[model samples]
Target: MQLFYTPDITDSPIYYLSEEESKHCIRVLRLELADHVQLIDGRGGLYEAEIVDAHPKKVALKLLTRELEYAKRNHYLHIAVAPTKNIERLEWFLEKATEIGIDEITLINCQRSERKEAKAERLNKIITAAIKQSLKAYHPKLNDITPLQKLIAQPFDGQKFIAHCEPGDKQDLSKTLKPNSRYLILIGPEGDFTPKEIEDALQNGFEPITLGNSRLRTETAALEACFEINFLNR
Candidate 1:
């Protein structure tokens, strides 16, 4: 089923697709007047719409039905990771994490981080595309890039964990995470977290966790953490 995104669906039953989306619906999809299409508001609302006007530049639709679907996981998964040096790798992680299941994501600038900033707009687009592609109703939240120290200072009600390579008695992530509970897991950069950074996180009540025996890249480790949380809930 082809799903189109339109976050702003006012109370009115009639809605017009954006210029870009209109072109795709009319020109690419060859949808004609009265053709039924699915629309997602990205806020858990899936609407069934019928094309009223088939204009390629400005297609209009009338809502026929609306269904509210909640997230698949009972608990929320929030992953904070330092952006990788290769921006593409970070983008890849964002896309995959959204497809797998993630509630929120925060990009952090660590002492050893290579990339300090990310395009929030671009990342949101990637997330939107991923949600549509994966047939997910809820849209994941993408937070702005923030400093590691600043992020840990904020209060979180859920369980907190930081995945690092520093040698110590760290529990396995899969075993450490509790099912049906909110989680915020931290994944470090390519160089991993510094001893001082690790200490700071621990002081903030973030437990140290291990991903696995094999060392993974920054993006890979972040995606692994995301997958682990979803897997446990499943």
Candidate 2:
């Protein structure tokens, strides 16, 4: 099933594909008039559409059917990690996390963070592609880059955890997670979170957790936490 991302599909029965998406459908995929295509609004709506005009630059489609989908997981999973110095690694984490199932993501700047910024546009594109590849109807939200202190200060309704390499009273992430409950996990940069940063998180009601014994890279730890949470919920 070829799924296209069309987040702005309103109540109108007809819709025009974007130029990039049009080229892919008409030119690359060679979808002809009357051919059926699938669309996802990234807002829990899946639509079955038929190609009305096979214009390479502006392919049009008529909606045939619509279905609303709920998230596979009962709860929300939010992972905030310090951006990796090598952006490709961060991109890889985003792709896998989206495929596995994630509700939200935030890039946090820690004291030891090497890269303080993330390309929102490019990262969002990666997320879109991942959703299409994984056939997910809902799009995970990508939050702007935030500082460690500011992020910890925000109010969260569910369990909050900080996964770090610090040797303290830390619980196993998989065991600590509660099924069907909202979760927010923090993964630090390559150099890891500073002592003061960990203390601050602890004071702000964030529990310290460990992924495992072996020290992992920033992206690896982030992805591991993402998987662990989803796995436990399953």
Judging by lDDT against the true structure, name the best candidate.
2
lDDT of 1 by residue, 1-234 (tens): 468988998668899999999999888988899889988887888888999998898889999998887455698888999998898998999999989999899999999999988889998999999989987878999899889999999999889999999899899866777788989998999899999999999999999999899899999999988888888888
lDDT of 1: 0.89
Which segments of candidate 2 are over 4 A away from where they belong? none
TM-score of 1: 0.96
Candidate-wise lDDT, in order: 0.89, 0.92
**Which 10 residues in a row give candidate 2 its minimum summed lDDT?**
66-75
Residues 1-234, candidate 2: write the lDDT tens digits: 567999989889899999999999977887799999999999888899999999999988999999887455688999999999999999999999999999999999998999978799999999999999998999999999999999999999999999988788899976677789999999999999999999999999999998889999999999999988888888
